[model samples]
Target chain A: MDVILNFIAENLPMITILTLATFVGIEIIAKVPTVLHTPLMSGSNAISGVVVIGAILLIRDAKPDEYLTLIIGFLGIALAMINVVGGFAVTNRMLEMFKKKKK
Target chain B: MERHITDFLYLISIVVFIFGMKGLSSPATARKGNLTAAAGMGLAILIALFSPAEGSFDNHIWIIAGMVVGSAIGLVSAKRVAMTKMPEMVSLFNGLGGATAMLIGFIELKNYQPAVISTVKSLLSNGEAANLMNGEVFSSIFALIIGAVSFSGSLIAWGKLNGSLRDNIKLPAPQIVNLVTLTAIIALSVMIMNGEEMNFALLLILTVLGLFYGVAFVSPIGGGDMPVVISLLNSFTGVGAAVAGLIYGNNIMIIGGILVGASGTILTVLMCEAMNRSLISVIIGGLGSSGSSSGSDREEVVKEATPADLAIQLKYSERVVIVPGYGLAVAQAQHVCHELEQSLEAEGVDVKYAIHPVAGRMPGHMNVLLAESDVDYDKLMELEPANDAFNNTDVVLVIGANDVVNPAAKTDTGSPIYGMPILDVEQAKNVIVFKRSMSTGYAGIQNPLFFGERTKMLFGDAKASLGKLKEELNNA
Candidate 1:
């Protein structure tokens, strides 16, 4: 009984969040109408930017023995930063796609 | 208290991000997507700034400063850039991702220190000393290489989209060079893994090689194949992020990366389908500029009919269909198209806009473009529904669109885009095309729609011509 409780205590956060997020993602995919995909995708891409903050956090807290951890965290932050910036840029460009052409 | 605040901010940012993603799934809410995403980013920044960290402050400051500078550049580009250059903008954005990954990787590698340092006596006596390496160096180096490759590759894609790369018959040597670069990168990865000390010099060299490989990979690819390349590179960025996440064991990084990777891959496939080209054929650089109907040929063939004549034609017609394409997008003439519909309806003529599934560059691209100009949703018809209607239609108006209206797809068995679905504009009684010139679409194939006898070319810019039609119809 103690072992099971310990397992639940250890795994609860990840398990609960993952299950909920996955379920929500699936539900959104199914229930949401197609007309909203454009903004939703852009929003999702923007949300993905949190990975950068996570990276920054890890880099700051990284221990000496965790040199590799810092690097990985840094990398994640950098890539996420790129995604956030690029995704916004692309979205902006896509918006202008219907703008009038100059003669 | 501060830590709790930071975590709360982080959680809120994450929720905003998810909300923004959900908002992006449709055209109606696309504009809102930008604001939602910007808010999420703002939240992320807040979290980063306030959150407690164990590392150097100076680096974080630099990162923050970089974000400000990058955002300024992006804002300026957004305001000043033309619509035609949107694809190039996507390429540039992709380049940012590539470059950022590369920079982060390079920085981590530079700051990297081994877990243990041997004594000076051990180094001198044996003339060899090993420093214990860790996962940080590996992740950093990996990101750098991947990012460098993405940056260069995306730049080339931008160049192609902007017509700077120029259309030409080219060799496949660049692909071979890319293959060589890949092998070297892999070998270098293995070397690094074998407890090698920080080799900044080697990494610098690899970075240069990867940059050259990016240019080489995209240079030979024709404009017709760019959307596929863009999508492919998008997938690469996601994969790079996923790799970085694995290196860090961050739950959010892993989740976000997987989401990007999976969606990007699916989008790449969808984009390839829109081009009516196989993903493999695009990778191999399928004949981008093999066929040519010269500008002079267009000059010789095109005869502009006044809107009065078009109006008269419409008056006599039993049924009329309008095919909206990228030309309509370039002209921003959906409103005028709507006006044309009203005019036709007044004449007791049946009019409908036939939208091909792959009409514009992306899926439902025509619909979104039209929607922005406030075209009625009811008037817009998808390929299948519109195709069924075309058989009885008396006239088909082919706007600035090319590939979608091409009859070659339906009739030409030997064509590269033989099996792709296309608008059956050829079945209509009379086809009137409004175009600036007879340029092929991204597929690099000349549209047979232009050459058909029933097709009358009204040579001009899409918006101007549509505006002209509106004026002429009103006068009538």
Candidate 2:
């Protein structure tokens, strides 16, 4: 109990940001029409690729002799980059088709 | 100073993501919205590379090489994938995201020894090693479990979507097994967190259990419920990423992950509602397993129609509504369907598409397929509007669609898909369904809509049938 309280007190600001962001997320997403659901899903799936940042940090902070951690971190970076790049590219492709119908 | 700059940029990225999502609320701005979000992601990645860190941060070559290889693979696959196979592609990419999160958690645990030792040393004087737990460590375990589950679950979903995995993989008492695995994982996680030493072996066991639970969780679900599963897994990946963010106190990751998580949850609920099932029932699986036995006993006479007949009826009709499903994509007939629509339109007939929310393998799957064939976006009508329009519609062409238009959903309470919303094609003056045979739909339930007096079945491949119709219409 004391440990949880200490952790909460130390990270209050980040927690607040997360709470507010959740509300904002629901509000924005609830308005997306059914026609765009696929793109909405794929686009947000891309956003979740923000873990690429964590992968970068993992590699940046690894010790010199920690080859195992380094390999794991490298794979993390590569896989995360795949998610980010592939997600966005595929979303763009789908959206482009939607865009062409406008003309 | 560097920290403040990084934080500020991340905040900016968050704002951009919000705007991007807001732009996706309608079709007019959806493409731009996606592009804006991609730009935000790029900005976040660039900022992360230059952000302050404790270690050497000198692994530039490794990072660049990884990015190059990953981007090449991503770009090529994105270009090569057919529009019909989009659901599989999305599932694969989502699995990659989940895998990345799991790896991050693994690496964080590997480097957690120093923190554990220091905390233990500080607590030795107090003789309370149990109180040595902190949020960073807790968040890492959370990420590990959720990420591992999402990763394996999504791969199974992808395999199912692409036909590489069979739909009916029987497990002996699956629910019980899943429950036990979940309980064990939770118990192991708590033990690792509260234990005196960092137990890497126990952590490995927990991860393996999580992965097994994911496979067990998704294996029993029928294919018709895949959209909900995919959406739920997408949210799992998002929540995992958010927890990873919590571990590092990264604002962009927190906000971005939360947004995806929220959106994916909404989509999951929407899909379940479309099918008239509760979230729990969908997760329990087996809705469509016994469908063939219950609905296959009917021996009603089916009326057949030729492509030439359909073409003429369609030509003389005033308003035509086309309902497309997964079969259309399987036959690769979207372009031919579009050609038929254009030919009918040239005859002064009004052509509109009625798109059920769960028409294909994923949400809005049919809309994307038709859009790829250059169909006008204005012509696609959603469920409610399409239902209303059916009252005035002169003809409905159900091309390779089944359950979405099944009248049994309205009349047969004993039907597996009872209470689910349907296209109400029976309300129209004439109905024509294009299929290869009288076989059941993805749900394996008989559609009485096929036997209705107003309905006519045109038996052939959707592409060849539609092509013949187009030729007939042109020659007429």
Candidate 3:
């Protein structure tokens, strides 16, 4: 229990940020109308691809001899890139249709 | 100093993301919102590449290769995928994101070798290092479990959406099996957390169990419930990414992931509410699995109509509303439907579309299809307004829709879909439904609307019927 408290004390700032961000997320998303749910979903799906930073850091910090770790990191970067690119492109495509219709 | 700059940029990305999301609240700013979010992502990626590294950047080639290959595939698929297959494509991308998070977590845990040794040493002393190590390990395990589940569950959902997998796969005592698996996973995770050394085999086993739980969780869910499943899995991927952020101490990832997680959760709830089902019932599956039972015993009196009759009725009507469903997509008839609407409008009839929230495979699916065919956005009416207009509507042409317009939802208390909100099509003066046969809808229940006092069934494929209706309208 002491150990857990010490860890929380050290990372209190990050935890607080995350906790507050959750409410902001809910507030912003609740206002979106149903007509844009698909685009909203895909757009946020793209945002979650920010994990690519983690993958890049992993690859950056790996030793040359760590072939297995490097391979895994490579796969991580590739998959995350796919998610980010595909999600945004598909969302744009859907929204473009909506745009043309409005005109 | 360099680390501070990168962190500042990440904060900027978070703010941009918020504004982008806010812009999606209406149709007018939606396209710009998507573009702004993409720019933010691009800025973040560029900043990440040049950010401070603990070690010299040795894997630049691999990173660039991965980005190029992934971009090519993403662009090609996004450009070529038919709008009707949007649900499956989104599911596939979400699964990829989950798989990426799982892989990152696995590497993070495996690379914590130095921390393990120090943790053991600190355990014999004051245990300062042990606390930090434990926190990192906890985040890694959380990300791994959630990511693995999202990955496999979303793949199953994608398969079901694309019709590559069967609608529902019945497992023997699935609930019990899932409960056991979940308990085992929790037990294993706790053991790993409390252990002094890294248990690689146990971690592997935990990942496998998570993947197994995902398949079991989604196997029994009917296809009609896929939107809820997909939304839930999307949130799982988001939460997994947020946990990965925790492990890496990346604020951008934490905020971005939390936003997606919250968005997905809201969408899941909205989908369930549209069908008047709770999230628990959706997860338990089997809502529409049974054959038609309640209204099957009664004599079904269905009225039949021809394309000419519908054409004549639509021509004389002052107002017409079309309710479209998944069948419209399957028949690839949105363009023809649009053409028919135009011909009716040429005769001075007011034409509009009534879109149920859960009309197609996903939310806003019918709107996307109608928009793709160049339908005016102003003519699309949501449920409440459409219901109000139905009272004054001269004719309601239900194209390939069944459950949404089913009067049983409002009147038949014993019906499977009772208490669900449905379009008030029965209140309109005339109703014409385009269907293939007397077969039940996705819910596997009989729609009493087919036998209503004013209902008429034009039995044929939706595309053929719409084409014939267009020809007849032009001839008249």
Every candidate's DockQ is: 0.16, 0.67, 0.65
TM-scores, chain B, all models: 0.84, 0.93, 0.93
* Order by lDDT, highest first: 2, 3, 1
Candidate 1 shows a clash count of 29
- Write one digit per residue (lDDT tens) for candidate 1, span B339-405: 7888778878888888776565445556556655555667778777878888798888888788777
lDDT of 2 by residue, B1-476 (tens): 77788899888988888888888767888888888888898888888787765445457666777788788888889889999999988888899889988988877775675333332112111233343266767888888888999999999999888877866566788889889988998888888877765787987898899899889999888647888899999999999999888877788888899888988898889889888888898888656665443455767899999878877788899999999999999999999999989988899999999999999998899999999999998899999999999989999999999988988888887777888899999999999999999988877787788889998999999999999989998987
Q: What is the TM-score of chain A in candidate 2?
A: 0.95
Model 2, residue B306: C-alpha shift (Å): 1.4
Residue pairs in steric clash, candidate 2?
Answer: none
Against the unseen true structure, what C-alpha lDDT does each candidate score?
Answer: 0.61, 0.84, 0.83
Residue B25 C-alpha lDDT in model 2: 64
Ranking by DockQ: 2, 3, 1
Estimate the TM-score of every prediction.
0.78, 0.95, 0.94
Worst 10 residues of 1 chain B by lDDT: B120-129
